[model samples]
Target: MDPYLLSRAVSELGELLRVNSAMLVTAESCTGGLLASTLTDTPGSSDWFAGSVVAYSNSVKQNVLGVPESVLEQHGAVSEACVLAMADGVIRTLGADYSVAISGVAGPSGGSPDKPVGTVWMAWAWPGGSRARLYNFQGSRDQVKHQSVVAAINGLLGAVR
Candidate 1:
């Protein structure tokens, strides 16, 4: 929850969206709507910020954002497959030029042998291509969520170039 870093992220996202003249949409899980909230916090955000879907539940991810049921079943919410689907789904569903998606277990609990707490998967999708990344951040739940949002914004900025 570093305000300075968050400010930089918001400024960078604003600049990127302004340069591209593109709209961005988000599909979020572990970070909830933090990514969306951060974008909308900027003034004149309506110029490029499209919308967001807080698809915290698998059913919402499948039904609202159009994430594939198979993807969810096979990879769960925090996997690369699911994050990619979420990114693509939000872009298509929201008619956005760029989209970012995130899912993770940001908690003191929910850690498994394979996926531990603070395990986050993020994806960015645009017209021609898409990419996803997995991060194992170390912190409290709030801190993990904050880091995920920062990463999501930075990933979106990176996606444009």
Candidate 2:
């Protein structure tokens, strides 16, 4: 990811959340802690940034974020069901007004017939509503992660409005 674009996204998201007095939590997998790190890059992010859970493993996803084992078994980690569960779980566990969850296969490997590399599943959840989307990006591992982070942040911005 370009440092400038990342900085811009973080700045924009920070301002929006600050104005709305909203708290956010993120559950990340393929992007690891990148999204969390990006958001925290902003000064005074503590106002609207609650915390993040890097649930890169299924055990952590289940134990920390409360993602159900059944969901993961049924839908895999990169499916809409799993992402939605992850988003809702993070909101419940972290006590954030909004939460975003990302799970993806961003690599030169892990490509199946149905799900190729760069296949990402992102979900956002608030008090009363939640939504998930599937995105297939084209690029290297770094690029896929970058695109996923941008999409996750942009989704939060849209949800605030």
Candidate 3:
């Protein structure tokens, strides 16, 4: 992991937490619990970071995060709809002020023509609304996951701002 970049991300998250004075939650899939782990790694993260859910499977996404079955069937797990649902679900379930969600095909093998291995979908949800974005990072599974976590944090910072 890039310590400098991680440090910067942590600093930015801390700043956002200080300014907005709100807590955050994370719902993760392809990036697993990396986003949550990174946030919790920082000292005093509990002041602003609420908690996280690692919804890796479709069943978990639907059952745990309340992602609609229709949305999953229509858009697939890597789609914007699923990510948005993840974000919204985390915020609603955890009662956090904001939430970030990520889903992707970060793998050495799970690459379809339409959605490649590095294809990642990220979403950020606040009190009023939420939005999702797509990213195509080029790297190995670990690298892609790292990129996804970084992007998710950046999106949260932007949303809070």
Candidate 4:
């Protein structure tokens, strides 16, 4: 992620969560723990940041976050269904008031005829509600991950508002 954009998003998210007295958790895959790292960069972020799970592997997603094995087999990892499950699972596993999950094909070589490279799916969950989306970002591996992180943060900000 760009330094400027990461700083802005982290600052905004910190303010929002502080105002709402809420905590956040992240479930990351393609972007690894970039979201968590970005958020934790802010001082006193621990006040509202609960925890994060870098579920980069399907096994971690299933065992740690409780994403159903069937869901992974049926829809693959970067699907709407998978991300929704991840969001719900992370919120429950980490016991956070709200959470975001990210899964994507961020690569220069993972492109498929259908899913393609840069295909990303993200989900945000709050009490009694959840939302998921798919994004086909165009870039190199690092760029794709950067875009996914930014979009995930933006989605959470929008969801809370």
Candidate 5:
């Protein structure tokens, strides 16, 4: 979650999308709009970054992103299945060439035995492919969020390339 490395990754992602003439969007839950904000921090990001959806509530995840109610019920937000659905939903909703979704519990309090604090799930979707991963980040809430955004952009670089 080093600031320099994070900025470098975001710059790289913007370059890749611009070079490919592709647009990227995001769906965020635990990270809120941090991912989108980071991308937009790039000077020319509007050319590549489409928009972001902060689907922090289950209602938004279901209504806005089209994440299935069943997925939430079965696996909860911090699960692979939920992230996959969220990624697909954002891509479809935003009509972007690529999409990244993050859902997690970045907590100092909201930890359960099953999905503890700092447990995060992320997914990236591009064209006909997608990837999902679980992360257990350490440190404060902001650190987990920064790490999530970094992992998400890195994941997009992997998929888009």
Candidate 6:
């Protein structure tokens, strides 16, 4: 993901959210806080950016984001179910009009046969509805994370409208 393009996406999203008078929040996992940081990179992001929850561990996902233990156990953290739960949790908990949640296996290790490295599940929620996507990115750790952030931002842009 080019820094310029990412900045542009952030700016575009900020503008849309501002125009709609909506707030945004995030629940992040494999991409860590990259998505949140990218959104905040633009100046005056606070107008629409609420905050983010970096739920790197299952415990945090279950506790802070209110992801169900059954969801994690049955579908794993890198599943559509978990990301959807996370998306809804962030929006409900933070009182945001829109939210994005990401969870993935982005690493040189720690990938199962079912979920290879770069397998990411991202979900975006708006006031009325939500959507989720599964991505099989091919790259190194940094590249995977970058791709996730790009996709997450793009998803937000599409959903927030």
For model 3, residues 50-124, the per-residue Cα lDDT tens digits are: 899999999999998999999999989999999999999988788899999999999888989999999999999
User: Candidate 5 lDDT, tens digit per residue, 1-161?
Assistant: 67888888888888999999999999999998999999998899999998999999999999999989999999887899999999999999989999999999998878899988899999999888888999999889998898888888889889878
Which residue pairs overlap in candidate 1's backbone? none
Tens-digit lDDT track of model 2 for 55-157: 9999999998888899889889999998998999898888989999999999989889889999999999987899999999999999999899999988988
lDDT of 6 by residue, 32-53 (tens): 8998888888999999999999
Off by over 4 Å in 1: none
Cα lDDT, all candidates: 0.89, 0.91, 0.90, 0.91, 0.91, 0.93
Q: How do all models score by TM-score?
A: 0.95, 0.94, 0.95, 0.95, 0.97, 0.98
Give the CA lDDT, 0 to 100, for residue 8 in model 4.
86
lDDT of 1 at 107: 87
**lDDT score at residue 102, model 2, on the 0-100 scale:** 98
Best by TM-score: 6
Global Cα RMSD, each model: 1.2, 1.4, 1.3, 1.2, 0.9, 0.8
Q: Considering lDDT, which of the candidate structures 4 and 6 is the better prediction for this target?
A: 6
Give model 6's TM-score versus the native structure: 0.98
lDDT of candidate model 6 versus the reference: 0.93
Candidate 6 stretches greater than 4 Å from native: none
For model 3, the run of ten residues with the poorest summed lDDT = 1-10
Candidate 1: C-alpha lDDT = 0.89
Q: Which candidate is the best by lDDT?
A: 6
Which pairs of residues collide in candidate 6?
Answer: none
Candidate 3 TM-score versus the reference? 0.95
